[model samples]
Target: MTVALMWEARAVPGRAAELLAWTEERARELTERPLRRETFRAPQDRVLVITWWDAPYDADLPELPEPADDLTARPVHRWRFESLGSV
Candidate 1:
């Protein structure tokens, strides 16, 4: 089954640009190509990265590490989902 990894972070006030740059760097660290991936940002400094892979949900894969505490308002959040069916 294909799996989707969602990694999210919220930067400290006015640090969204820094957080986005940091996550962009992490995306380049992938060991293999994903089926598709996307990154999004919200007005409140929230950043989200979603990467789809051609592997099982539990498959070992590279993941983003926690960013500097000073750059984030809180710890990062991650979740995995398996594709059910396409619309």
Candidate 2:
């Protein structure tokens, strides 16, 4: 099965660029993992981080830096797909 992890969060009012840079770095790091596939989309005031990986593989979601309280974090939602047929 393929697993997808979705996370949404709001960046500080004027820190969109900073958030993008931070996520880029994290994505680069995540790519080093054999089963990791990650991408991001920013819409309105939220950032959508989507990651796909093998069912049993481990994934490290990027951790916010110090001053972590600056951005609001949302609960993560995960789904597992048995096949890619419907996607």
Candidate 3:
């Protein structure tokens, strides 16, 4: 099975760049390499990171951590999904 972990955060008014850098650094520092990892940006200064792993849906996997409170406008959001295969 393949599992994709999603980590999303919205940065404070002017800290989007810093948040992105922090997220990228943390993703790079993950001890275990995933099948694939990608980062994205969206409106409202939100940053999203997705890491795909070849493991069970409930398996433990490395994930990005929340940034400093001052850097984020709200608590980070995360979700885990089991891939259903591409069309």
For all the candidates, what are their Cα RMSDs to the real structure?
0.9, 4.5, 0.6
User: Against the hidden reference, what TM-scores do the models get?
Assistant: 0.94, 0.57, 0.97
User: For candidate 3, lDDT tens digit of each residue in 1-87?
Assistant: 999999999999888999999999999999899999999999899999999999999998988887999999999999999999999
* Prediction 3 TM-score vs. true: 0.97
- Model 2: pairs clashing at backbone N, Cα or C within 3 Å: none
Per-residue C-alpha lDDT of model 2 across residues 20-66, encoded as one tens digit per residue: 66656665665334244555656644555566556543545333232
Distance from true location, Cα of 1 in model 1, Å? 1.0
Q: What lDDT does candidate 3 reach at residue 82?
A: 92
38, model 3: CA deviation in Å? 0.9
Predict model 3's lDDT versus the native.
0.95
- State the lDDT of candidate 1 residue by residue for 1-80, as single tens digits: 89999999999999999999999998989888788989999988999999998897789978778999999999999999
TM-score pick, better of 2 and 3: 3
**On a 0 to 100 scale, what is the lDDT of residue 87 in model 2?**
40
When sorted by TM-score, best at the front, the candidate numbers are: 3, 1, 2
Query: Which has the higher TM-score value, candidate number 1 or candidate number 3?
Result: 3
Comparing candidate 1 with candidate 3, which one achieves the higher lDDT?
3
